[model samples]
Target: MLLHTFLAPLALASVAGPAQQDHYGWIHLFDGKTLEGWTEKGGPYDGDADWSVENGVILGREAEGARGGLLYTEQLFGDFEFECDVKINAPFDSGIFVRMLPQKRGAQFTLDDRPGGELFGIYSNGYLFHQSGGDAAWRSGEWCHTRVRCVGHPMHLMGWIDGKLVVDYQVPEGMDEAFTPEGRIGIQVHGGMNDPEDAAVRFKNLRARRLPPMAGENFTVDESGMMTLTAVGEASGWQPLFNGVNLDGWVPNGGSGPMTAEAFEAAGYRARNGVIEALHSGTAGEIRTARTNYRNFQLRMDFQLTKLANSGVYLRSVDDGTNPSFNGTEVQILDDFNWEAASGSKLAPYQFTGGLYGAVAPSKSALRPIGEWNTYLITCVGSRMNCALNGTLLWDVDTATLEPKGGPPFAERAKAGFIGMQRHGSAAESESEVGASFRNLFIRELPEMGPSAR
Candidate 1:
């Protein structure tokens, strides 16, 4: 069906699609002349004054001795981006409510009061993300544009006033079931007090779009010719090591200076359909992130290999002119089915997919065959490490206890270094080109240990 077919019944669509849209296209939540998809939080008889549509804007007001209420959308959203233009009359406590449960627990972006555009949470028994600050973007009698985005996995909120980013915050973990994963968006009118004269709020041009699993996690290129890993989960904390477009964040292993577009292609890193492939490079060596020096992080990626292919993932590795296979801790990725026959012996325990190179072995093989994709989630917090492949736990050990392998003492490996991926030369007998393909390379650095972490 066309885009209009899905959105027309709700409201007159303000914007439609260009047909090839990959993300959520725009949809109008308000239909200017009526409140079709909205209902009052309390019944009409419970509120002091009624909310009504007037001159293309939704207006709410209360009398001097009246109690205020909320107008909410019947539809619920989990991760989404919402935008509207609001004009708040003075002496009114008004705000935009998002991800609110039926019991009225969620977060709010304050509109007017002490200051403007402050974020407050109703979860965790009333928490304030940040205090209201600066001048109020809303004029006494004029309209101001406001935008809000909330995402899942690690719940977060980002907001803007008059096109300027004002609030960016991440809800801390451990308050499970308190903040509802799916809830209705609400426009709140304060309950206690009201202005004797101009006690009202008007909202118009209201619209919303869906957000990703995490915020700012997509691999996108801006007009500046630079790459950006939009913040995901937390505020601007997660970044993509390989953005899957150009090699903007990587450098050829053992090579120095800023990596250029030409040098990246010459090094045999090609991106197609969101996957980075190491093809025909003939062990051209591994590629490492130019920023390097990562300490504690959770890294995730998906890999697919051909029969008899071989490669490795290196973490916290050094660049001493030696290969990352020897300088860093490698998570072995080899063709396990044919390795024993090709090498004339059974595959060693440490030579399988999730092994820690030569220092430690994976508990069992978690390979998903040669053609199917397998996911790897590797998390390193200080000296302890945990790895899982294809939904199966592979190895969880303290690197501080392993015997020394080669370069640094295994216990005293450099606290921070480069991240690399090895390209094995070729297979033993077939000599066919050996390479691997990887996608969705997401990484997030963990915060330092603190009381909250405990």
Candidate 2:
């Protein structure tokens, strides 16, 4: 379902203070006195009716089942910063339109009733951008403080509850074109409404600030004005984790039978759609990291699973020049919720989502709702492995033992080598599907382990 389709009025947009202290901050889209540089564009409003303005808010009283009206600023822009304070009753949703080409490019930053409501997807053009944040604290009849920035190619959106950046996303490039040639800023009354239960959106304190285009150089910066100059050059070479189109750098190992890279990649092990995906049915080989090893590092990826699929990540591996799971230890990834993934596997609490694949179970179940992207970050050092799933630490283990009797073993935990991906057999489960989807795969190798922090 489209994000705007759901309505959960957030508490309130921030009153925190100007996002940019200087005069180059936000240019108010709503001038309390009148509709000024704004107008509606949707159902029944017929570009005729006047949207009410009281106490500074531009109220959008929704029409039953209507897509709602679009409020566009009289001005057009390119690279800029947009921020606003919005509030509405329950079931009401709205979005800040930016760089819209109207009939072509759609809203880049969409805010709705759901918590952490900042969505990055084109109108019907679909999504190629994402980074979302917000809490489910949105109830009816409240206001929300939201802010968005599109400078260079990275779109940073912050959804503030009352007065803080509750959700922040630094959108990567490649998903551009949502904003058009200095287009108008308009408000929409999203199509599909019926009765008072549909939704109503009211916005206030709107502003947009134009900024300069960003180059690769703009990527380096913290909260400090302490600017450091440097030259723009190709970054030093590093082993590619994924080809972004195919799994040309990995080999899966483990469980029952033989699984080859050719076999795995042939079954659609791909690096497409901005993510690396592998669909396995009855494979038994581990996918080993192509080059290099790591003593400690933060490895992160997003995935969606099918019931009964079993897999894991092997770290500090010793490549036999072919399969690696036979050498390194493994970190488990399975849809414990699926009876199939859990078949033969004990149905326990921590064992479900982020467990250490049979050795040490998680302290908590951190899996996301099905179909939602769940993130896992693993840090290994010595005999210690700390894992966090979706911002929550689920497993913290020390002095672990690995056994191939069931899966892979780690005799060299304190040592370092390659990383591996696990492939479980299909017949092992009821439905017997041995696969899932993985995307946004990235890793930042940590410094060599020093004295045990444990």
Best by TM-score: 1
lDDT (CA) per prediction:
0.65, 0.51
After best superposition, candidate 1 residue 387: deviation in angstroms? 0.7
Off by over 4 Å in 1: 1-236, 258-262, 280-283, 404-408, 427-434, 450-454
Cα displacement (Å) at residue 205, model 2: 23
- Once superposed on the true structure, which residue ranges of model 2 sit more than 4 Å away at CA? 1-240, 252-264, 282-284, 319-327, 340-345, 348-350, 400-414, 427-434, 450-454
lDDT of 2 by residue, 332-358 (tens): 676666543233334544346676654
Model 2 TM-score is 0.46
Query: Per-prediction TM-score, please?
Result: 0.48, 0.46
lDDT: worst 10-residue window of model 2: 1-10
For residues 134-204, could you state the per-residue lDDT of candidate 1 as single tens digits?
24454555788888888763467878878877778887787545677767787877666645566688999
